[model samples]
Target: PFRSTSLPSSILRSVQLCIQLVSILIFVRVLRSKSMEEYSYTMEMHQSQISDRSMRFVGRLVQRRTMRWETIRRWFPSMVE
Candidate 1:
């Protein structure tokens, strides 16, 4: 009768430990995945901002080129005609 009672207590302790370990592992995995998602989102935002700036720079260059050509045409209309 004494051995049977002690055996159940030991088994219960081991079961509790196992449950604690499993819950910890699950929590760590969730945190890792959330960090990865945030990292990817930040990277995407940075890339889009870089692309937008480059596009604006290109637009400015094109406008400058067109304005120079127009000035040349105005200064020497006979040459273009």
Candidate 2:
């Protein structure tokens, strides 16, 4: 008779464990989505940096193309600024 009463309590404990596992799965999914958003934001930052780096390269190329200059801004970029 006591065993029959304990059986229901064990079933209740198992149900609680299943609920905890489901909650953990939900938490993991939310974390994955948040990480994906951060990854995309970093990608956009990299794209902007590429444009900025290209602009600096363009200026250096123009200096090299035009050999006629008072100062050697080609060698010393600080002088160009």
Candidate 3:
């Protein structure tokens, strides 16, 4: 009975601490990678391949401007809207 009473108090303290930490994290400024800078760097690295029929980066193929309208519609559904 003594152990059970102590356990609830500790659990309540830990729950309060977690709630505070989460609130602080929510207001904190996020410092992450500059994606646009990396994108430009990637483009520069593949400058020669940019003119090819298709460009491969990682595993995704940046396809060439296809003549088919269906392909474009499939790629970006919002374009039709």
Candidate 4:
């Protein structure tokens, strides 16, 4: 009884952690490959373009309504902050 319950919970926690790590790595790669620096006085518009492109690429498989920000918030603590 207890064994079954605890095992699944522990496994789920590990899986979630792995996914979060992969997401972070992918995020960094996308930023670096695009050579995106902090938006400057004249590059403010570019920031939004970059953000939109990143979001589309990373979140393509994830359904907006199903796995919304709230759901990922649980796995990625930094995202909440």
Candidate maximizing TM-score: 4
Write down the TM-score of every candidate.
0.34, 0.33, 0.28, 0.35
Stretches off by above 4 angstroms in model 4 are 1-7, 35-81
Model 2 CA deviation exceeding 4 Å by range: 1-7, 35-81
Expressed as tens digits, the lDDT of each residue in 1-81 for candidate 1 is 446555787798998899878756654654465333333333343444556776556445544566665676689767644
Greater TM-score among 2 and 3 belongs to 2
Ranked by lDDT, top first = 1, 2, 4, 3
Go through the candidates in order and give each one's C-alpha lDDT: 0.56, 0.53, 0.47, 0.49
- lDDT of each residue in 1-81, candidate 3, tens digit only: 446556778788998899868644532411133233333444445555566543445213222222344565679757644
Q: lDDT value for candidate 2?
A: 0.53
Candidate 3: where is the Cα deviation over 4 Å? 1-7, 30-81
lDDT of 4 by residue, 1-81 (tens): 446455777798998899878756756664554322211211342335565676554434333333454565568757544
Clashing pairs in 4: none
Candidate 2 residue-wise lDDT, 1-81, digit = tens: 446565787798998899878756654654465333333333343444556776555445544545544345557666554
Per lDDT, the best of the predicted structures is 1
RMSD score of candidate 2 (Å): 21.2
Rank candidates by TM-score, best first.
4, 1, 2, 3
Q: How close is candidate 4 to the true structure, as a TM-score?
A: 0.35
